[model samples]
Target: MTRDTQGENAPSDLDLTRLLQTLTVESDRYAERFGSRHGLHRTDVNALALILAAARRGEPMSPSALARELGLSPSATTALIDRLEAVGHVERERPSGDRRRVALHVPEAGLEEGRKMFVPLAEAFADSWAGFGPAEREVVARFLDVSTEAMKAVSAEWAPPHESQRRR
Candidate 1:
């Protein structure tokens, strides 16, 4: 009988919304732990994840491209790449005809370590999805895609990085 300001059910009382929010928080904690275990900073792990994602999509990532995706300056990205290279986590190469572009690559050892860390969780996810038929899985995928875009759009309108944030 009562309507909130939005004239809809409050998100706090929505099971799916709460579950998605909680998953986002828990996933952040998991990512932090995983990064620590791999001797990488959280952002470094995120960069590697992005690189792996691009590779999976058959589009290799370059240092400048990674900088753009990571929201880092060119100098900062170079420093990050240097650290990873020192640790044998990534290799730099000119994969394309553009000699000025530096392609980032995860060596076999790095890939193996990543596999060891993530394979179990990936298998569990796959096993869970195995219970759903193709139609159900498709619906779930579509929902996730829409949810992601909605969140992204909402995020763009949120308080952006101010002077205080930039100082950090």
Candidate 2:
């Protein structure tokens, strides 16, 4: 039996955590650089990406959610949303139950434009992934799924008590 860093004979999530942190840093840098090439501000590009992601996941994107995800002030998020809306990248619709809340949707044109800009990078990733066998890819997929769940759980349960107040 092998021992992990804790010196106990057990498997651990430490590897996953380290890999995730490195991947997040490099991926964000790549996204920022690539988005800059397309003439969009990094934060604006990040917001657009988030909104698109939410739509793809069949979840609604509201300004509040975007703010938390992007770590932006509410006013900053509103401004970012306003810019996206003005450029036809996103459209804000008031949800039926809450007129005060804005639900964001990406226009088809925006998706098309994003695809045009990101396809080359996606192709590069596909080429890199080509080395992985099906079994390896499946394991990676499972790891990512579990990692995402872990992140969601911690985010929900472990924030500082004054964190929200500090923002206000």
Q: Against the true structure, whose lDDT is highest?
A: 2
Across 83-107, the per-residue lDDT of candidate 1 in tens digits comes to: 8888878898886678876778889
Q: Give lDDT tens digits, candidate 2, residues 1-168.
A: 234777877555666567789999988887888667656688988889888889889999988989888777788888888888777788989889888888988889888888886898889889999999999999989988998998888886765655566567
**Per-model TM-score on C-alpha atoms:** 0.81, 0.70
Q: lDDT (0-100) at residue 32 of candidate 2? A: 82
| RMSD values, in order shown | 4.9, 4.6
In candidate 2, position 148 carries an lDDT of 91
Best prediction by TM-score: 1
Which residue pairs clash within candidate 1? none
